[model samples]
Target: MIIFVYDNSFEGLLTAIYEAYYTDIKPRAIVSDEYYEPNLIDNRIYIESDITKSNKVYEAIKKKISQDALRHVYHVFLSELKEAPTVIYKYLLIAFRMGYQVDFLLTNQHVLNMHKISKKVSREKHRMLGLTRFQLIKEDFYYAPIEPDYHIIGLLAPHFANRMADQHWMIHDVKRGAAAVYDKKEWFLTEVDMKLQASVGAEEELYQELWKTYFKSISISERRNPKLQKNFMPTRYWKFLTEKKQS
Candidate 1:
């Protein structure tokens, strides 16, 4: 068996795929070097992230396949599932042979897998769009922390940037140790090693209390349904919600 190791970045995965097509022997697995533990029997190939190679693969997909399929590739990557890179490689292999029609080939497991993972990523992105709540922190920064199952912080950035274009905001994915920061103009993602100092403003505290009171006042005790509420707003996200906080 052969294993292809990459830098864990999307570009690195693309570079690995580029090299895989030209190799004499096909790789059995494509994995990030960070998670890859060397095996005694398997042949390992380390791939460096290359912009040119990654761009070539991207352009090829956009040209040979449909733009919609290219979007599927991105969404599947954002799923961050363990098998995502290998599944993408497999999907592309069939795509290169079958052209744009490969997307409709539900009989093909790889294509189906791509669609499944893409759906998961899209669902999380949509959920975060509605469920995310920001608090006013020190230095006039609007900080929102999320713990999505998928790598969706980047996906959430554009929506908030457009909605709150005049403000400086940061969406921190605490689980992933990454943050998407917007500075009134552009938004970018960065890896954060240390915990952020999340000191809420006094006005923010007042708003939180008021919001919680409003939430309690509007709910009819006899009509309350915890199960229904949990279905829409999962219990896992309650920690960050102002209305859910203890008075």
Candidate 2:
């Protein structure tokens, strides 16, 4: 069996796909170098990320397939599933042959799996938009921390950049040690230390207390439903919520 390994980046994945199309020997699997485990029986090839080749594959998908298919491909990449690279390659193979009709192939396992994974990533992006709560840090800047199941910090940046256009803010993905920072003009993604410290002001603390109090006061004790609450706001995300955190 032949396997292609690449840097754990979307561009690198695209470059690998581009090479698979032109190479005489096709790769049985495409995997990120970070997750790949070598086997003596399999021939492993390391693929270098090339921007020009990546762009060609990206444009080909948009042109031959559909814009929605391109979006699905990107979302699947952000899911970080171990099998995503190989699944994308197989899905694209059918997409290129069938064009837009590939989307209707619900019977095909690859196509179905691609849609399922893409929808999961999209759902998390939507939920995070509402669940994210920013706290005033050091009197001026706002910071919000999240540990989403999918890699979605980049997806959330544009919304916050437009909504908080006048303020400097950051959305940190604590799980991934990366953040989307906005400086009142543009937002950019960068790596941050996992042990990052940002002290909240006294006023911010008071505001959090007041918000918690308000949340408790507005609730009806008789109508309280723990299961329903957990359904709406998963327990994994409650650690960052001011109201959910223990006083």
State which candidate has the highest TM-score. 2
The lDDT per prediction is 0.78, 0.82
Give the distance in Å from residue 179's predicted Cα in candidate 2 to where it truly belongs. Answer: 0.4
lDDT (Cα, tens digit) per residue for candidate 2, span 1-247 = 9999999989899999999986787999999998999889889999999999999999999999999999999999999999999989999989999998899998999999999999999999999998999987544567888999999888898889999999877787888977777667667776654454435455556445434432332243432211108777899999888888775
lDDT of 2: 0.82
Ten contiguous residues with the weakest lDDT in model 1:
219-228
Clashes of each: 0, 0
Worst 10 residues of 2 by lDDT: 219-228
- Runs of candidate 1 with Cα error greater than 4 angstroms are 196-228
